[model samples]
Target: MKIILSPAKKMITDTDSITPDGLPEFIDKTTEIQKWLKSKSKEELKTIWKCNDKIAEQNFNRLENMDLYHLLTPAVLSYEGIAFQYMAPSVFEDSQFEYVQNHLRILSAFYGVLKPRDGVTPYRLEMQVKVGIGETKNLYEYWGDLFIAENSIENPEDIKGFKRLGYAFRPDLSSEIEYIFERKIETMTR
Candidate 1:
């Protein structure tokens, strides 16, 4: 029962009490993306990131010094956002942490996909960001069935905009996020 989640833009590098327990499954793919980003000029990266000068510069520096093998923190503790803040993994009991390690995954533009305990560095790349690698024009194209073909996703439901229809949670036809989730599920189920 793996639950996929979105990566957060906000991040912090802290592993004071926790030791990273897992390695990213897609390190090779992430390295490829990082190499491409490293090759771009700061201005080009700023354009690609769609950020202000300061942010662009910061991320550019991060990219320039990006090393997949060093200075890593666990993914669950590395991200900071509404969902992760509420999750409060720092206080989670050992058993709960074990549950998270086995049942959760985070999708990313940089890392491709990450297990909860996967060792990750701080970066700013959204899953929706367009990054062309070789002939691939965007992240979706670059990923190209890699995620779906690799994982065993049985049911993908998006509760983002779903509402309780009396007793049952029904799909929102107008919700594109929900559509992507459902579409992925449909494709996998077929």
Candidate 2:
């Protein structure tokens, strides 16, 4: 199976802190961050693409860096006059271990193994979903899942079999993302 994601866009912490090189500095204001992100020119993107390609070639297991730029690095999402962080499937997975921002993994329009229940459509709209097992679905069905808080979640779309927070996004993430995926694969194997 192959996994892909978007760029690792940086966001300023908005506080004074010592850098890894032990430099004292303070990060305040979103405009500063935006300027930094915009500083990357097309040449930089090409350079990064070459470097990331080498890394991918060396570490063949990781997903490929196919784009010249982080294409999925969409403009920042603005909510309530504040900029909420952007969520890219590639980026979210790359930084999933960091566990900072939780989001739905988009699994639509790809050639990959396994998929979420129902499909990726509902998950993309931020709606709850119910995935089904024992079915051989294509890439469209493999968006994985998002766990909304109890009572804080909205009603799921028309799909059924998507077990609600019946599981936790704890240590066992594979299960948390798609509980039915394994069974579906096993069914296919049979």
Per-candidate Cα lDDT values, in order, are: 0.73, 0.25
Model 2 poorest ten-residue lDDT run:
117-126
Q: Tell me model 1's lDDT, rounded to 2 decimals.
A: 0.73
Candidate 1 structure quality by residue, lDDT tens digits, 1-190: 8777777888877767587885798788888888888878988888888889999988877777777787788899989976799899989899988999889888777887788888898898754556668877678557645664544444444233322111223345535442322223213353
Put down candidate 2 lDDT per residue, 1-101, tens digits, no spaces: 22222212221221122112211111122123223323445444334334455442432221222221222221111111121333332223435523322
Which pairs of residues clash in candidate 2, taking residues 3 or more apart in a chain or in different chains?
5-90, 6-90, 6-91, 14-27, 115-142, 116-142, 117-131, 130-162, 131-162
lDDT of candidate 1 at residue 87, scale 0 to 100: 93
Query: Residue 146 of candidate 2: its Cα lDDT?
Result: 21
Top-TM-score structure, candidate number? 1
